[model samples]
Target chain A: MLNKVVIILTSILLYKVGGKLSLRSQLLKGILEGCILSIINIQPAYGYELSVKLQQFGLSDVSEGSIYPILLRLQKEKLIIGEMRASESGPKRKYYKLTEKGQEALQLFTHHWTLIKGPVDNIIEQGGKTDGSN
Target chain B: MEATEIIELNNEKRTRLTEHNLKYYEDMLLYIRLNGNKSEQQTEEVLLEMLEHLLQAQEEGKTAEEVFGDDPKAYCKEVVEEIPTEKRKNQASLIMMVILQFLGFFAGSYGILGTALHYFFDIGSALTTFSIGSGLVILGIDLLLLGAFILAILKWIKQSTFSKKEIKSWVEFLQVWAISTAFIGLIVVIHFVMPSFGKEVSIPTYYLAILGVIFYVLSFLMRRKQNF
Candidate 1:
């Protein structure tokens, strides 16, 4: 009986965690391009390296391969440019760096993020407090 | 580097992937490659980049699923959406190359066979008869049929990439046989129904062979210059 109860609770917990992960990924998708641009702005990085950095910075929910599409979009928009270069461990890799346009875009994204972050944080915190009071 | 060069490099580098990862990666590769109208250079470059990234992830002991997520087909669609289409000039050049090559091969084979029949079997009069109007109509119909067939085949291949069912070789063979029979049947019908109204120009079968050679050579040069 104890084992069955434990199994049931564990399953519920796992389900909730999976649900949160999906939700988190959905939320992250919007801001991911900006995050990528910011990282590239700091230093030029290849696809895998960029993913590692994002994961190291605690954005582990972001799928590592999802960056390629964003990279392609940024390239098409002329915001970033990629150059093929020799890699340390594998075959030649395409290293991406921001163009002037990309830098400007990054700045604009940063500005917009700043504008929304505080308001969003405040609203969420107030909502939490209201729930607590109730 | 040229697109062809990148493709060659990809072929070499992709061997490093594990069997499972290679299969997954190749599905994406074929999906992107089969997407017509995209810039070849960009397509190849992005494919190489993906291969390199996958290799790196493989080194870290991560499965392709972990890196790329489970829904690879969806991810491929996203990638394809961003890839730019080929320039008009490049597309035109490609079309010209195909048409020229087709014309060359058809004329060349007809010339060779006609020349052989004329000389060996003394069938000279039949070999010399040429009708420009019916010839042009037949060429037009052939080109249209060829284009449609190519598009259908490419669409079929693209749709099959993520399909769950196992495609049998016999089914594929039957499809090719059907298309081939249809193509030949249409040509035969056109020859029977269409009137030969154009002035009859009697030319030596050898001359037709020469014209075919010239077209074939032009196509070869264009292909080399374009490096497609």
Candidate 2:
């Protein structure tokens, strides 16, 4: 029991340390998926609306400087396509929609995420206790 | 929190964001705005988030008195840091290649002068013209060999993204080689070939050899640096 307790504490410590280390990667992964899902959950989106949604997930690193590169990369990869639509605000805004490939990728990503989330949520709900093995 | 409530975002604050990292910050904003379920109660939530970032900057010991402190370029630089560096070596290589070709052209001219000097000048005028012609040929060849040095420097400059010192070193290295080659050529001609054929075939034979060496050296360097 004592050894188990010690193991749990060490694992939690590692989790805390690692969370800080992988903050950017985690934030980017979360926001990227969230954006993709937002479009799938809806249809298409412009830059402004997507930017607002990314912030709500506690990701502050998604500045305009950071996000545009990812968008460009997605376009380059042929995962998404964009078209310009006139906005009530001022100029036309670029509205992006998932490509066929993007939709396929989103489906796979969702399936894998669901699989990974199960054990993860199990641990979270059980307060990190498991069946005597890692 | 009502759906009817509207909020105004300060255009000046929003316009301040820019980066050459292919619109990184823009993507970030767009992602948040589209995905965030912020209600109208959070009407200016998007703008407020950005405002909070600026406010946090002050809390972190940023200047309180200043309204907007950092320049747009400074923020742009930060964004650029997030992206990969551009391909610059190919550009530098092309520039160096052009310069090398020019040097080869000059070297070819020197060879022409060496051949001409042997024919045009008697022993009296031959010595001076011969020396100058030989020197320039070697100088041209030296420029060719130095092209390799330019490649190395270009590699260094591309990796560091600053300092053109490597280029300067290449130029100086080539200059030294040119001078040295000229001196050696003069010595070889005067000692061996200058004494033969009653001074008729004398200057031409040795001058040709020296020009040949210079051309050979240059050609070797040029072939090595084909810019491929």
Best by TM-score: 1
- On residues B36-70, what C-alpha lDDT tens digit does candidate 2 reach at each position? 12222222332333343444444455331231222
lDDT for each residue of candidate 1 in A1-134, tens digit (9 for 90 to 100)? 33334333433422224432354443455478789999999999988888889899998978888988878888998999999888777567789999999999899778867766675566555766655675
Query: What lDDT tens digits, residue by residue, belong to model 2 across residues A1-134?
Result: 44445444434422333543254444444447546554634667765456555656655454532444455445556677756566566544457788888877677666655655575555566653544555
List model 1 lDDT by residue over B94-123, tens digit each: 999998998899888888888988778977
Provide DockQ values for all models, in the order shown: 0.59, 0.14
Candidate 1 chain A TM is: 0.74
The most accurate candidate by DockQ is 1
Q: Which CAPRI level is candidate 2?
A: incorrect
